[model samples]
Target: MLVKHFPGETIGIIGSSMASALLAQEAGRLGYRVASLVLQEQNPVRQFCNWQTICPVYDETALRHFAGRVDVVVAETGLLSHQDYKILAAITDLTLSDDLMAITTDRLIEKVFLDSQRCLVTPFSMVTSLKDIKEAVEYIGFPCVLKTTQRHLPQSSDHVILYSEEDYERAERKVEESTCILEAWIPTEKKASLTLVRNERGEMLLYPVFEVIGSGELHLKQVRYPANISSMVEAEMRRVAQVIGQALDLIGSLTLEFFITSAGVVYINEASVGLSSEAIFTLGSMSMSHFEATCRALVGLPLPDLLPRGRAAIALPLVDLNYDEVMTQYMMRTDWHFAFFNPRGHSVEDMQGYVIVIGDSIKHCERQIELSRLTHHPK
Candidate 1:
């Protein structure tokens, strides 16, 4: 059963990442008291939250006590174990359900669930041993990616791309160490995602689709709102997202990432519950940001009317830049919005901060991104 929270009620947040901080800020704006459970006393989220509890999520007694003090709990890290889920469910309402977590946490299970819904997905095969690697390669062909099936694996590089037989031999060794899944690498023309919020009543609200532009290494480079896609394609993507959300009985926000091939075929890449990193780009573009929508859904509030401001692009730095330096340089440009997560020692690869540029047109946004890239990361 779903739980409801009213204004003035406390919202407990799990994890201490930028998403948690953003959620706390939005919840506070809506008159909801926010408390965060953090693993460290120096967590950045602590500054935005009303109360901070320093305790590991797996510590049942501590988690139960934390839950008792809040009306609902939202997890941002997506690192909760089954035991952790059990403890949270027993004490407080979770933004994501345990059953949904079980399915989405594992890449294989998530793919299977999408397939069961008759949703188109990338060609994939599950590999449990070295022998399965050859079979997977034979079916998926070369230039495929082998990803670990381990739920919540903390390793930064969980997937390896294989382009040749020699690469396959190396991938086979890597796969043998753990269960893996082989997926054919689609020559994607564009990568887009639809972020939606769903309530227990089956009501749904859709945000404008955004194109995910990535660097050569697959790190997010920029996100462009109102994806460069046709109306028909956008409608189909929204329909698929709605179907998946309704199928899971999603209680809060859900994001469905899709790969659009050159032929215009859309294939499901993955789905995530709660907040996603790319959603930050929606801050100034949408009437209701993803964080606000998630908070509203969690507290049983009606969805707000989503209206777009203008063409917007979110640029993520590929190299670390001094926050003050970047801000000082762009301070005169009112069209640019800056947000630094304050992950002090983290590299650009960690997605620490982003710049949002709103323009009169998409071409203008692209020009801004190119100019900023050249200025910040010159060749």
Candidate 2:
């Protein structure tokens, strides 16, 4: 049986994003009042979100005030300051803070489960001072990732990889201002994400494993599901994800990133504490919205089994609007579909264009995306 939280209550979200907006819509659809705390009214393209219409929280003062008004607070944007989580945690009624300390401490939220028998973690140490850096290097060796401990950069990627003593020296200087995690970079053959929801009772409902295709784009990359990775690797990824979930005492929805190296080793990367819309999109394209999954999880309702409905689906972010003239090039394609669109004249800050394509095969889908890029992308 699924566990339930407050029914028909309002749920608060921090950050104005397509993910938050879609999540808010889902909550409202599920009979709960939804309010999003955001910084601006204008839609800023959330590098990590799909749908748009996020509520704006313009400033720190606004965020503090917004936190006091909602019953349940969820931070969708990874861009959080310490003040954000502190304010949300202060709201005793009910609150879900994302990987605030996980990112801030540089401890992969997955590391919270290092004690578990299921995990094989790399040698790592916390960097608190300049001296700690030397110990970390001595212990973990070179070619390690130096990252802040907080989830300060939720929507985008941050942190530096040190491959030499000189690189480590520069990264160590920044350590005094933030908690850093020092860990060996695992070179994996493939990468995947496990998005799941844990009921209040601690039972976990694992979503289908989704493959993460690396992109040169900082955070606005494409993710494909119904992965091509080994079923064994997928199973192990799920197993490790569950271990991390239980260890963190994670509530509601979460996402765990992993590296499945050519050697068949699955190294846990990071953990996301709130709803993962990117993974949700993969599921959404397949069948149901992850937004619905979150809503159902929040209310303690049994989740519907998700089956792949579409064979191949792709989402391309409209990053530059100035190239509006080029849109006609993609509009010419017969194989693509506009799953979502921005109202005419309504502009987005981070991304100005949007298109979603679903085809009969991944090859067709990839071809459409490539073709669209060739025609519309600015030279």
Candidate 3:
């Protein structure tokens, strides 16, 4: 069944991707119908108010049903079957590419572009067999890292850092599971990402490059705006992003990750094709949301005119189970939204939970968060 007023006008989301929920929020706010696909395990009845869930057993059938119902169909996380994308093309517009491009998935494609273009990239080689692995190590050097060529699946991101022959052999069992890309591990002096968006008319919007500081565990610790890098490096990052976007013939938001070495060298890290509202939200605060931009783009609308007003914002994820108990006792001073203790409902991975708090000063933000840690209190 379809809504009567906006007959044949609904936005379709293929998975429970973060972008799906965020964009659904915006679309729902604008009185547009949002129909989402829910797997068997998900709660189909309790989707966000702005959206409805449609379940289909087959990929092509699902695509056909959704195409008939929605004006725009967006696949989040690149999780949909390729055949689904082909089917989606028959009925409605399928916009937005998976964000994790160049740096992760499709490394060969990335290499092809890098080879022809002057844009700088991390040195990498693909490993198809055991012999190829040895050759790759010899060519790319030791202490090099092994990752998959296709970044489509979750397991593809699992990697091993080879320090020795034994380490290479130890990693061989796992490396043989997928197509690997071996790259020299550059010691990162800093990490930053640029959120780039382009409309159907090709007007590009570049958000303030945000710095990501972490412990190398792949867990994001912090995000800061107006990236604190040398002007030369900053300019280079933007130039590279612009070049890549043009090369991809990109139409929506693109997220690019980078590494700035201690030697003032910059290396491309990773990229995602669609608008990452979570990352952009951390940098821009409430004034602008990538969710809104994505909704407009999917509907063939222009991007919301937004500018970085120089307001500093920070986002920290709270992964402890006893988050609320700790916050009640110590975090009495600062403002924060405990995602795990949501009044509406609980979300996935509450144990690996998250909370968002904003502060006028970075020092204030850090202090408040540090004081609120679950490990420091009297047990």
| C-alpha RMSD for every candidate | 3.8, 5.1, 5.1
lDDT digits (tens) for residues 251-362 of candidate 1: 8888898999888899999887777767777776667778888888889888867887765665555244445446664667765666555543556444355667777777
Report lDDT (Cα) of residue 136, candidate 2.
79
* Tens digit of per-residue lDDT, candidate 2, span 1-379: 2234565576766665566656666677677776655556554323223222334433566666766766666666466655656655665233343443443323545365453445766667777776787787786777888776665644225667888877856786667667776777777777777788765566666766776555665235655655677888888888877876676665678777777778888776766677675653453355556667766666666666666656766555545322453356456755443323343346543234334566666687678666555335455
Which regions in candidate 2 have their CA more than 4 angstroms from the true location?
Answer: 1-8, 44-64, 77-92, 95-110, 115-117, 153-157, 201-204, 214-219, 246-249, 320-356, 359-361, 367-379
Candidate 1's C-alpha runs over 4 A off are: 55-62, 216-220, 315-352, 366-379
Computed on alpha carbons, the lDDT of every model, listed in order, comes to 0.76, 0.61, 0.62
Q: In angstroms, how far off is 233's CA in candidate 3?
A: 1.8
lDDT of 3 by residue, 129-213 (tens): 7788788777677888887666565576567888878886756876677777788888888888887776666666666678765
Q: Work out the TM-score per prediction.
A: 0.85, 0.77, 0.78
Score residue 367 of candidate 1 by CA lDDT. Answer: 79
Of 1 and 2, the candidate ranking higher by TM-score: 1
C-alpha RMSD between model 2 and the true structure: 5.1
